[model samples]
Target: MKILLLTLGLGLVCGLQGLDNSAKGSPKLDGKWFTVALASNVTSKIEEGGSLRIFVYNIRVYDGFLTADFFKRENGKCIPFSVTAITKEDGSNLVHYDGLNDFSLESFDDEYSIFMLYNIKDGEVTIWGELFGRTPDLPDEIKKKFEEICERFGIGKDQIRDLYNDDRCEKLR
Candidate 1:
């Protein structure tokens, strides 16, 4: 009985170690990402109609910290802004940009994730999200996952916008 219990304990430890190693190898959110889809329920001047009107992000990860340059689309224009994305805690996969306009990571996979952006002021909270991918397009499976996230967040299907094939920012690259 003692030998069997020891074997079980070793197996559990090995399983946990393998899980941790696999997580380390998961895709890192470091690249030039384009917005593929978006959804939100926030109503503010910044988030007019609760949608990300125009945006693409070039994110760089440095020692677990994140910084990004935003290319905002407007009136047939792509405006630019630079900001730092802060990791909320040690060993936590989520990162965020905390400011007048806050952006946070809700979840991620190999090609894309549901990124949430929000603004809170005057005791009001306004949240928006974008499906950001390394490229302009996402695989069908990834797209489905993003849709699921939107649904779980109570964002209507109609409210989701697909920015995947929009190549307006090609010149910026």
Candidate 2:
């Protein structure tokens, strides 16, 4: 009984520590962001008028979760959308939107970030490579980096789309 009590106490302490750490939030990832480019194994998902072609306004991280606010152009109208992902203990993010999305931060800095999203819906799996920048326009080198990352994920350059000039959702931005 004493051993069990000690183990329980330790577990509670560890859990609290984790919660406190998570509360500090992902500072580097919390800020205004724009969708610079998108690549997907499923080509249609990143094509024009595709559901994955979204313009991000900002991202907020808090309480072990990250929330993104963005706009999606549908039927010639801009529609606002928000997605929240819980940060797992292992530093992964899980989102439930239109499907179960497992997002992993491939690389990030203050100015740019690349995220890989694995989505499973209706027994179909799709991989998405998303590139975001602090500004709408990204340098050629940054775009090259995104291309390299996409190549690593089996997404060819042809599958990538540059959304820098896409202003359909600019009003919402």
Identify the leading candidate in terms of lDDT.
2
lDDT of 1 by residue, 1-46 (tens): 4453233223221111112212566666667777787676642332
Q: What is the C-alpha RMSD of each candidate to the true structure, in Å?
A: 10.9, 8.7
Error of 2 at 18 (Å): 12
lDDT of 2 by residue, 84-170 (tens): 976555444677866776666767777898877766677676778889999888999999999998897778999998887778376
Worst 10 residues of 2 by lDDT: 8-17
lDDT score, candidate 2, position 112:
90
Candidate 1: C-alpha RMSD after superposition:
10.9
TM-score of every candidate: 0.66, 0.80
lDDT of 2: 0.74
